[model samples]
Target: MRRHELPRTHAAGRTYLVTGSTSGIGYFIAEQLARTGAHVILTARTAGKAELAQRAIRHSWPQAQLSTLSLDLADLSSVRAAAGHLATFADRLDGVVLNAGVLAQQTRRETVDGHELVYGTNHLGHFAFAAQIYPLLQNTLDSRIVTMSSYAARWATLDLTDLESSRAPYRGFATYKRSKLAQTIFAFELDRRLRRGQSSVSSLLAHPGGALDALSPKRPPMPVATTAQVLRARPLSLIAQGKDKAAWSAVRAVLDPQAHGGQLWGPRFLRSKGEPRQERPTAAMTDRVVAEQLWQLSEDATGVKWPSLSQPRRL
Candidate 1:
């Protein structure tokens, strides 16, 4: 059945969980989903941010079904707790947007789990959370896990020996890019596993092309770039887009019927910023060897794995 198109039944609406919805592209993803009358769950590092995001969504989409959960992806305990709370909070889950992530830190940082902050929060944390909630997602009739990735993934190269970049020189931007690449690899690997298991759950990826805060719309409660900044960004609009518009790709992956597992959704213009459409990922993005390796490393690092998916087969 098409849950997205289904009438708002008395039982409840299609439930979608969007992480890091307190601001940036994550907020927009949650907001857009709420606008469709879906019961959107917003997650932030703290209860305050979550509440803020929920309020902002409610203010604009008053009728929009909304809830909030505190999730600190930098901490595995928090991810587990949030997933536990999430499983109990909702009876059904239609989709999950893994949109929460730290980007472009000026200095290299480590997560509470002792891994690189960028990789830990963006990839490993989500991986563990997804595993924690795998059963809930499986119970849902048809569910999808849409990963919010980046164009930086294409430029990334993984050093499995030093996934944390401790041994290697670490540029904050380079670490961030590698983290996105790791997560992107995980997304494809997950889809393959789901397909192999014949599960109803699907995994997909979306990248918001060159999203800039300066180009985004002012949503009131949330902060926005200054008028001067916006004006200065006008010339760059040819290639970049506002964060609000950038969110459409992830939103489409979460709810669009045509969005299938393993497919990438991105911008139409310059493949970065425009209407959401099917995007062609580069060869590196779909490399199964690296994906398989990353999956093993992720399972080992997170100490979480899907029990039913232990066939020991590679595609």
Candidate 2:
């Protein structure tokens, strides 16, 4: 479906924060929210990129309620500072899309904080940000936190003993898959905690299955089995959907009235390309023990702990 043909739920007066909104799927997600009358807080690593995103959104919808904030997900200090700035915005936030992430590189690297780059940016940064700004979401009525994962998560084998890949040999694709798995686990664990605490806030996960977009610079070679799976997929990766369609899973998780916490959404076909829908995730992706372990590791790594709530708050 075209961007215009996707569901555009009314979001007038609601405020949403989208990380990595300067380009690609993040940009499209922000644009869709802004077009529906939501006040979109678009984040970029630099002032120039943020300005460009704002201009693009305004050009498309002159009346768009938009703002910009600087965020570098690879840097913990920057993530904290950005969260602090966002906390000052108002009493509450209607939604937050944790969409910023780094693609797999040819070699392993570490973030400024000394963790693996992909793990730090894709999972830990968002983890810290979410913990800090969770109060805002809790106060907001029926608020949602939509985290972006990836199909690469299916290939992940998270080693609790070597969460940072320091003790094991590092492969770029494996590291990237680990980061996505961390995100998936985080989302599910968060939802479980929220429900256990009886909080109104919801946590949802979404993935842009095989969309050809800016963040994905090129396709990496797959194993024989994975390659066959892709080949059998409808439409194949040769003609995969664009970022806008890939972003719909996230948009739906964010705005669809039927969407609920703890659900994972992705494309409707072959886990590659199609419209957004609820999809079954791998068993490892939904493993509660793994999720709890990851939650603890995230807290330790980021030094940010989620606030404990005794009961659900009225919206």
Candidate 3:
């Protein structure tokens, strides 16, 4: 189908909360959604970025319904506060794009919540946020939860026994891969739970293949000074694709009628720069038993539980 032939989202009165909307692919997706008339809540760690992004969006779509919210996914308290704030502002949420995340940091650090920086920010935080906001989604007509994963997740091993990586030394890129794998596993697990309970909310996952966008702009610690050395070693612009393609994949997942629950979408070509295709999560990431275990672990770690579960375990 042609570019214009694809279904454009019509979200006149709907409300959407897109995490990490201040930059990169998240910003693109949130902007597109706001342009379509959705009351979009763009989240950032600081008020300045959020306000800056909101203003940029308004500059383009003058009448756009855009707002900003402070959310630090690495901190569970912040996640809870954001969820509560969203609940207070809107009775229901039509869609949520879990696009905010960090990349391979050179050093080993922990969030205020004490989770390994990569796994904490990439997976656990989002897990808590999603679980806390489960009710808001449940109240919507056809709510959707969209998570951003990565191709590196395929290389990961789900080491649930030591989820915090305290048992092993910090290996930057590998840890990132593990967290992404957790995301895929989390999405599958969430879908299974939703299916078992027959809930209307659906979970979907997507990946933005090697993009040149500054995915990790912050500096790494001295030990891992060459943290993003790989990017510098190669011509990133040549090897990496554009952010627009990733936005298309997200838009389709959020708006396409044919998009089914639990589906994973990515670029259609070898370089991840063409049309989007429906891809299944890797076997390691889709194991139902592992997913359930991860879900239980996440609940224990975050202290948030979905009420729709048949057995609501105390966190």
lDDT, candidate 3, equals: 0.78
Best-to-worst ranking by TM-score? 1, 2, 3
TM-score of each: 0.92, 0.89, 0.88
Q: Candidate 2 — worst ten consecutive residues by lDDT sum?
A: 215-224
Candidate 1 residue-pair clash tally: 0
lDDT (10s digit) by residue, model 2, range 1-315: 453366657888899999988888898889889988889999999888888778777876789999888899899899889888988765669899999999887777999999889889999999998888888888888899999999889889888988777755678888889999989988988888888888889999999887755323221221123444444643555547767778889998999898999999888778777788898878998899988888888999988888874365656
Q: Where's the lowest-lDDT run of ten residues in candidate 1?
A: 2-11
Winner of 1 and 3 under TM-score: 1
lDDT (C-alpha, whole model) for all candidates: 0.83, 0.83, 0.78
Top candidate on TM-score is 1
RMSD of each: 4.4, 6.0, 5.7
- Let me know the TM-score candidate 2 reaches against the reference structure: 0.89
Which whole-number lDDT from 0 to 100 does residue 209 have in model 3? 72
